[model samples]
Target: MVADAMELATRALLEANLGLAEQVITGDERIDDARSACEEQAYALLALQAPVATDLRTVLAAIHAAESLERMGDLALHVAKAARRRHPAPVLPEPVNRYFAEMGRVAVQLARRAEEVIRSQDVAAARAIEDADDEMDDLHRHLFTLIMNKEWEHGVASAVDVTLLGRFYERYADHAVSVAKRVVFVVTGRMPGTVSDDDL
Candidate 1:
């Protein structure tokens, strides 16, 4: 549901909808609760079943993925709060709004692809997620360039707010990529850094 939350947060920012921003903020509690419950269940299984090897790794990956998902929710909440903080005024300038809108769309796509990678254990999808994250990083850099340009007239306050929003979206994509990497690790039994193309 964090993907849905991210979409709502993006909608809130793009439209300057205070109601959607408030919903994203309040909806974070649900993500927190769900993460807690999933973690508790994972721990219970580990303790009760004494799972070994692949089973243990699967459980560990699930817990880690849940944490990543929760972090994604928190990042989405930050985006919503930034939007609400600006109220009717957009946190992003009109010229840069399209970049942010594209970033938001890419973020949601990464989340969806991450879900597919997790369920299918498709190494190609996992690798694709990392590639998608690179796109997000490029967008983040472009955002910084816009903010830091000498001709920028949005003022320091606007620049700071835009920077934070960019970071939130960038980090959100990072977490989604991390989730995909974890799935690869679980399926292949190779740690993230140790996994080569042949292994994937």
Candidate 2:
């Protein structure tokens, strides 16, 4: 669900489509609902089954992943709102648009991989999510460079918009990596460092 929202929100932002933007914005509630439902289910299992060791790790991982997914949804929401605010006028300049488009693609990929990791619990595949996130981080840096370049013609407002939008995409990927890392920890009993919201 969050993956779909990210894809739609990216499209809406790129095309400056108000209808799509509105759809993403309004659909955020569904993601929130899913998060709530997931937590409820996880809690019920915990109480009823008295899960232990690997079983407990699996239950806890589900809870963490759900929260990360919800956060990814919120990031997508932020992107849609940015698009709506600049409707009839693009949020991104032409030079940086392609970068954002690529970021969006990578964001979607990471989200999909995270979903698969949860379902399959393939430790190797879960580790690869971090590599994909590194790609997203690289894209974020490229966009930031474009924004901060002295030759940048866009005004401060536009630069700020692009920066925040880039950050939103980067953060979304981070959450996906977080979800995957939790799954890896569940399987291998080793936790990786995750980027926090306050990191950037």
Candidate 3:
């Protein structure tokens, strides 16, 4: 289930990066379906296996992780939609595009790492996922600064579109980090990091 969710997330990110809004939306529906199936299966495991303690944590974490991946897919679709709406504007500045691409790359990498940690029950690998998430957060902050400064300034509409694109990408990274944190809790029996209370 984690593998399937991760694959969908990877596809969604790739589609958004390529400006395939319609395809991203279509893919999101499938991801939503997979999320629902995973949720039901996790609950079924709980009822049938009578899991307890750490076992229970693993099942619960799987469900949460699936939901987080679904949210990441949704955010990717949002970015694709924003891209579609901003059509005919000049392409984003090279630097901004480069940053966005790098952000997406990090997101995909983290998603893959999270899946590996879950599959292998490797707590050490989970720590690496957390560290990778920190890098993503830093990248997001840098992109936000660039967008706010109107470094490219295609125009008012284009600027708004780019700003929203950056936000969507950032939110996508955040959800991936959230999934990694859940993996940490499932493996270690405790949440590993500080999270802001403020809404993004």
Instruction: Identify the runs in model 1 with alpha carbons over 4 angstroms from their true place.
Output: 194-200
Estimated TM-score for each candidate: 0.94, 0.96, 0.79
Q: Compare the candidates by TM-score and give the number of the best one.
A: 2
Clashing pairs in 1: none
Q: What is the lDDT for 11 in model 2?
A: 96
lDDT of 2 by residue, 55-112 (tens): 9998898899889999999999999999999898998889988998999999999999
Query: Model 2 clash pairs?
Result: none
**Residue lDDT tens for model 3, 1-200:** 32333334334333433434556656678878989999999999998999987899889988988888787777766765554554443335546666666776776677677667767877778667667867767877787677677455655665676666666656666666667677778878996565322134
The digit string of per-residue lDDT tens for model 1 on 1-200 reads 88999999999998999999999999999999999999999999999999988798889989989999999999999999998999998888888899889899999999999988888989888988888888888888898888889999978888888888888898898889888988888888988873212110
Best candidate (score: lDDT): 2
| lDDT of candidates 1 onward, in order | 0.88, 0.90, 0.66
lDDT of 1 at 73: 97
lDDT score of residue 170 within candidate 3: 64
Q: What's model 3's lDDT at 147?
A: 65
As for lDDT, the candidate ahead, 1 or 2, is 2
Model 3 worst lDDT window (10 residues): 1-10
Candidate 2: residue 193 lDDT (0-100): 65
Q: Which has the better TM-score: candidate 1, or candidate 2?
A: 2
